[model samples]
Target chain A: MLKYFEQLGHKLIEWITIAREFIRLFFETVFWLIVGPFKDKPVNFKSLFFQMVFMGVNSIIIVFFVTFFTGVVLAMQAAPQLDKMGAVIYVSSLVSISICRELGPVLTALVIAGRIGAAITAEIGSMKVNEQIEALETMAISPVRYLVAPKFLALVIMLPCLTIIGDASGIFGGYVVGTTSLKINAGLYLQTTWKFLSRKDIYTGLSKSVVFAMIIALVGAYQGLKTKGGAVGVGRATTISVVTSFILIIIADCILTGIYFFSDM
Target chain B: MPEKEIAISIQNLTKILGGRKVLDNVSFDIYRGEIFVIMGGSGHGKSTLLRNMTGALIPDSGKILFNGQDLLKLSVAERERVQRRFGMSFQSSALLDFLNVEENVSLPLVEHTKLSPKVIDIISKMKLSLVGLQGFEKYYPSELSGGMRKRAGLARAIAMDPEVVFYDEPTAGLDPVVCAVVDQLILDLTRKLKLTSIVVTHNMESVFRIADRIAMVFKGKVEQIGTREEIRNSKNPIVQQFIKGELEGPIQIT
Candidate 1:
């Protein structure tokens, strides 16, 4: 029991150390992003543009396909339950509300955590292992300013935009099911989606996506910068980054959802 | 020995890694325009010492005084100001893989200076040419040979015209011919650029060829420091064992 407690204590300490470092990295990136431009030491916007292209533009197809299919599944499942209640027309509202309020943001974040999150870890991990990060330091360059800040900015901006796209595609998928399979009128379907999908629902999802974006970017960069060993280390960091981001995204979503659900917002 | 200007004075520098003293109170002075080589077998903390001096790894304790200003005592902004005068060439040539050679060389210049792109381009070309990597400017690091990569790394290190240049195992994984070429470049650049060069390596041949003075580290300590000839004739058994490449010595193989 004593040995187990000792092991537990060590694990706790390790986790705390990691958390501290991660927080430090996050704040440092934020500091650079905010203060860099005024000092004539701006976060490299050219690199930021490239990162935006990779993290945002490149991710559209995957986000579209995933959410679209999810929308189709949601509509299909809801049709039967509503049919039994003699409320088959309510399928459109169910699909849109859920897609905008819950599914779109969560799914898009998960995909990004797997895609761009893994990429960030792999790239930075390899750089860390190769001593390129140290080289940057020796050149009086902050790796956070040069690498992570741009990535953070790009992801923060792009993830919400992607979520909006995901929401649209998912609702479109539901539209297909409603009009074709359920034989609902086309105009009514869109009207029902708009009616049920309040501005609050869309904003809440967008806000959740922003937080999720921060989690993915920071977690990926933190793991990447912390990576040691060699090729194996990069692989391990990438895995942990994705897994950690996934967990954090869900936890954050739950907390935000709780806040939104419980409190009068 | 008469009043040579000290470029960098390392005072009782100690660094502990994984609860082990990787650098145990090591102290040394590297004079301007001299090639100071820190040579030791693998894992004796030579690289760690280099890292400490270059400000890549902060020492657990002790001072790295660059021209009498303590690096550790400075504010982050001041430390960076001092750091801008130093450049480090990594063993793996750690060039950003995505960046072509010209961009890699121009990185320090681009980051530290507000030079126009045209001037940065010209300066990068000059630095590349100094390392004999002129025409390969457009080629990415992945496309370069090991020797060319090292050269490109060297070009990047010198981009800022730094006062002190640290080379971590510059010729570690090169063919003998390429190793000799790198050694010659180190010697030529040291003279031509008038830069203080600190090299960390276990490559004995390159050490003898390029180093004005050599410091042999053993068990996280500076076992001996001397001129090449002095080190060649040193009475220290550990130094002799290392220089002679003998199996039986004070240094345990384990």
Candidate 2:
């Protein structure tokens, strides 16, 4: 038993050492990638464009559909409850505030975490397994600069864009639910939603989306970059990146919401 | 040969994994424009030694000097800069299945050079043709046969026109005919391009065909370093056993 414990301890230490080296490589790559664009070498606009298309354009449809469904479900659930309290007219206000302030950004991030996060992880992991990462290193190109930096920048830029679209689509969904299903006046619904929504709410949602984007991008890239073994390792990293990003986004949403609500109270 | 132009000088190198020594105080030097081969049986640390020379793995002790500068002492960036002078072909080919022959061959140029895509495309096509893979440029790795994939990998390795190229078991998984083609390619590249090549292989035929000098690694240390004739004439019992493929040797298979 003691021998087995010792073996386990030794393995743990080895894993930790590898993890430390991975972290160091990741940060070092990030530093060089940040500086690479300004160096003597010209920036690669083609790579940047590819990243924008992958991180932004490819993800829009999923974001739009998910946000729309979330809005519809929230309105449908809230309508009866609001009617019970004789506050049926304020259903739009509740839906808009919840969806815009929290649901829209968090749900959209979750969708992207599932879609784009997995892709980044799988792509980088495949590069690692195939030794293309090693090839890049051999060519005096920082793999992080050539690979991870563009991904990071793309996600950071596009997450907010997706969030804005999600916010609008979600509101539109609530309008559909209220005016069609609940027979509420469309003009009154819009007015109530406008009255309740604030600049702080929008800004807060966008800020959370930004934070979630960073986490998803960083964690996904980190996991992918650290992948070893081969095909099996890449697959495992992709799965782990999606699952971890989803859990972290939810946890972050709770904490942010707690702070936002309690501070106001 | 001038001492200043030594491509690689490894001294007193040691590597330990799981407290077992993988390479023990191994030392060797590779001169410019020479085909140096490291030969050993399976699990004899030949690949480990190659990886150490390439700075893919750092030694627990000793130095790897590339062009007189200690490769291990350099930062990752600096090490990578040194690595640019070398290219490697992995045993498994390691081709990107998603990328076609042209894109795969152009990877190094795309990553490290500011050359326009048109120029890169032309250079990529040239490399493919040089490897006798001209019309197959649009085919992905999965679409190619085993031999063609290896040729494509070689094209990629030489795309940057590296001074030194490393081949890890280039003939391992190929038919005899394909192996001959690969061996001929290695010879042609060395002679035509004046490139220093280090090949690790257990294939005795490959070693005899391409190696200007051969180093035999055994149990984490170099057991012999000599020309093919010198090695064949060696009186060392282990060398005799290995070269003759005798099972009754001092090298106990574990």
Candidate 3:
């Protein structure tokens, strides 16, 4: 019993230290993003552009497909129940509102957390192991400023954009199911989606996506920068980064959803 | 000889890593424009000491004075100002594999200078040429052989025309011919640039070939510090055993 408590205490301290480091990295990254340009030490725009392309553009197809299928499944599941109430057309509103308020942002964030998050961890972890990061320090370069900030900035900008695309594609999927499978008119389906999806729902989902982006980028970068050993270490960090990002994204989505639901905003 | 000018002074440097004293009470002065080699067997803190001197690793307790300025006491901005005059070559070469040779060499210049892209390009080319790597500027690091990668790393290290260059096991995984070539490049660059070179290596041949002075560290402590001739004729058993590459010695391999 004593040994168990000791182990638990050690684990708690370790987590606290890790949390502190993670917060520090986030602030340092933000500092570089905000202060670097005035100091004539701007985060490299070229690198930032590349990260945007990789994280946002390359991810579009995957996000679209994932959310589209989800919308289809959602519509198919909702139509049968709503038909008993003589309101099968409500399936359009159900799919669009859910996609805008919940599914689109959550699914898009999870996918990016899998893709970009893993890549960030692997890239930074390998750099850490290979002494490239130390080489940067030797040259008076902050890896956080040069490396992490651009990634953070790019993800912050791109995730919301991807969520928007995911939302549209998901609504299109719901339209397809409602029009063809359920024999609802296409115009009525579109009208129902537009009517149900309010500005609050759209903005709330975008806001959730923004928070998820920070979580993914920070967790990935933190795991990466602290990576030890070598190739195995990078692999381990990548896995942990993705897993942590996934868990955090879901938890954050739950909390944000609760806040939006109860706060009456 | 005129009194040697001290470039960097390490005073009672100590570092602890993973509950072990990786460097303990390490003190030395590297004179200006000299090749000071820190040599010891594998896992003996030679690299750790080099990292400390290069400002890559912070010592737990000690002062590293570069040109009479204590590096540890400086603010980040001030430390960075001091650090810009320093460069390091890694054992693994540590070239940004994503970048081509030209871009890799130009990294420090791009980060630290207000020079235009064209000027940075020319300067990076000049540095690569100095290391005999001019023609390979377009090639990525993965496309280069081990020897070429090391040379490119050397080019990048000297790209800023730094006041001090720290090399960690420059010839660790190289063939003899390549090792000689690297040693010759180190000598040439140090002589031509008048830069203080601090090399950490256990290779006896490379050490003797290039060292103006040598420091042998053992178990996180300095065992001996002397000129190559003085080290060759030293009375220390650990020094003799290490230099001679002998199995029978105070250094027991477990």
Question: How would you encode candidate 3's per-residue C-alpha lDDT over A1-265 as one tens digit per residue?
Answer: 9999999999999999999999999899999999999999897889999999999999999999999999999999999999999999999999999999999999999999999999999999999999998888888889999899999999999999999999999998988899998999988888888887789999999999999999999999999999999999999999999999999999999999999987775
Candidate 3 structure, TM-score to reference: 0.98
Chain A TM-score for each candidate, in the given order? Answer: 0.99, 0.88, 0.98
Q: Which candidate number would show the highest DockQ if scored against the true structure? A: 1
On residues A1-265, what C-alpha lDDT tens digit does candidate 1 reach at each position?
9999999999999999989998999899999999999988897878999999999999999999999999999999999999999999889999999999999999999999999999999999999999999888889889999999999999999999999999999999999999998999999888888887789999999999999999999999999999999999999999999999999999999999999877875
Question: Comparing only chain A of model 3 with the true chain A, what is the TM-score?
Answer: 0.98
Error of 1 at A208 (Å): 0.8
Candidate 2 backbone collisions, by pair: none
Candidate 2: residue B2 lDDT (0-100): 57
Tens digits of per-residue lDDT for model 3 on B65-175? 999999999998898898888888999999998889999999999988999999999999999999998789899999999999999999999998899999999999999
Give the runs in model 3 whose Cα sits over 4 Å from its true position: none
User: Per-candidate TM vs. native?
Assistant: 0.98, 0.89, 0.98
Instruction: Kindly list the per-residue Cα lDDT of model 2 for residues A1-265, writing each as its tens digit.
Output: 9999999999999989866865675575567556775774433567667888988898888889999988899888988898998898887988899888999999999999998899989998988887777656655666677677777777888999999999999999989999998888888889999998999899999999998987788778888987898889999999988998999899998899888777789
Q: What value of lDDT does candidate 3 attain over all alpha carbons?
A: 0.94
Comparing 2 and 3 on TM-score, the stronger one: 3
Ordered by lDDT, highest first, the candidates read 3, 1, 2
Candidate 1 docks at the CAPRI level of high
lDDT of 1 by residue, B41-119 (tens): 8999999999888887899999998999998989999989988888778899999998899999999888889999999
Model 2 stretches astray by more than 4 angstroms: A1-33, A41-43, A258-265, B1-5, B75-77, B96-99, B114-122, B241-248
